[model samples]
Target: MSQVFIVTDSTADIPDELVAKYQIHVVPLRVVFDQETYLDGIELSPATFYEKLGKAKVLPTTSQPSPVEFMNVYSQILNDHPGSQIVSIHLSSGMSGTYQSALLGKSMLEDEQTAEITVIDSKSASYGYGLLALHAAQLAQAGKNAEEIEAAVLKLHEQRKLYFLVDTLEYLQKGGRIGKASAVLGTLLNIKPVLSIDNEGIIYAVEKIRGQKKAMERIIQMFEQDFAGQRINIAVGHTANPASAETFISLIETRFELGEVVYPNIGAVIGSHVGFGTIAIFVWPA
Candidate 1:
């Protein structure tokens, strides 16, 4: 059996320690703040990125990694591992071009070599996507074949759920995720929209609760309802909102028997749209 190499983009939000432990390779997206551009996790740490986010006059923009970057990573992995298979898992294609780039890169490889790489669009983001990659890595390390890893990941991907609450709609409006008119109206009405990523990889507003507290409660309720009878592995994601994340973790621990609850800082690419005080819950059947 060939060794399997795992690859993922930074938006998956897998912790650095875990990445090192699992021997996973991550290709970071680019974050542009005015004249300065930084690679997602390479040039910017989450704490530093959030600090600059607060003081920036203009909102930062994110760019996906080029196909050449993916090609280089994949080629190097194959060279090092000899006959190993590469599985590149990434954030939703609908949300970013990272997945597309990986696919394009894989297509560019020679016919015989192409079969060595498998790219998957997780159709999820943040820790939600991270959990999928982590699970894939675990299976690969356990000597599972590429096909086996793909089947396991797709199974979890279908059942995975993500619910997020943002502090304000300003960033969403700026990102063009929500219309300016809707942002204004939502802010005026104090409406906190609970958003979810659908199976198609698009983020959609699921419900609008009147207050933040209610929104938090609604997130838990929705999880209980949709995820009933399912043993879950939960991941809590936040953009500089430790307090809200803590509250979310506490609620989950109190109400559910969660597997491993991983807390990872939302990377710059995803954080740029959600802004601060964003708390997201990622749940997968255990």
Candidate 2:
């Protein structure tokens, strides 16, 4: 039986320490500001990205990892592990081209003497995708075969839920993720829209509430109604909004018995679209 290696893009929002500890390979996306491009989480850290984000006159743009980049990682893994299988998990194709790039890379490696490369579209982002990658890596580390690991992750992926709150609709508006009319209405009503990832990994507005506090309360209420009886692995993501993230964490700790609560800083690619003062909660059924 061959070993299995796990790979994911930087949008997973996984910390560098954990990436190294788990031996997970990451293909970085690019973030461009003012015609200068930097690898997400490679050349730019979250803190640095946010600093420049605030100062820059133009909004940053993001690009997925190229097919060549993905091929490089896959080739190296094949060289190191000989016939090992590779599981490349990534953000949703609906939102980014990372998944498509990975697929192209797999096609390029048809002649390689490996078990196979399985490219999975997490249909989610940030901690939601990170959690799936983490679980897959854990399974790979435990010597599970690629098929088994993929099966395990697929089960968890179906049960995962991501909810987020953005401080301003400007970033989303600029990205064309939300309509201009809706953004204007939201701004006028002081309505903070609570957003979620659908089964397809596409982001959609679930509800619009009056204030940030009410939005948070509404998130907790929805969690209670939908996930009350289930044990969960919770992850809170923030972009320069530690206070709000902490408040969400506190509420979850008080309300549920969770396996663990991970606090990961949102990385540049994700931060660029959501912008500052973004707070998100990722819950996976335990």
* CA displacement after TM-score superposition, residue 205 of candidate 1 (Å): 0.6
Tens-place lDDT per residue, model 2, 1-286, is: 7889899999999878789989999999999999999999989999999999999999999999889889889988988878799999999887888999998887777665433788999988888889899999999989999899999999998777778888787887787655322434444467888888777777778888888888888888888887887887888999856777788888777787888778889999999988988998988776
- The alpha-carbon lDDT assigned to residue 281 of candidate 2 equals 91
**Candidate 2 ranges with C-alpha deviation above 4 Å:** 112-115, 179-184
TM-scores for the candidates: 0.95, 0.95
Predicted candidate 1 versus true structure: per-residue lDDT over 179-206, tens digit per residue: 3224334544778888877777777788
Give the TM-score comparing model 2 with the true structure, all chains together: 0.95
What clash pairs does model 1 have? none
Candidate 1's C-alpha lDDT? 0.85
Residue 273 in candidate 1, Cα distance off native in Å? 1.4
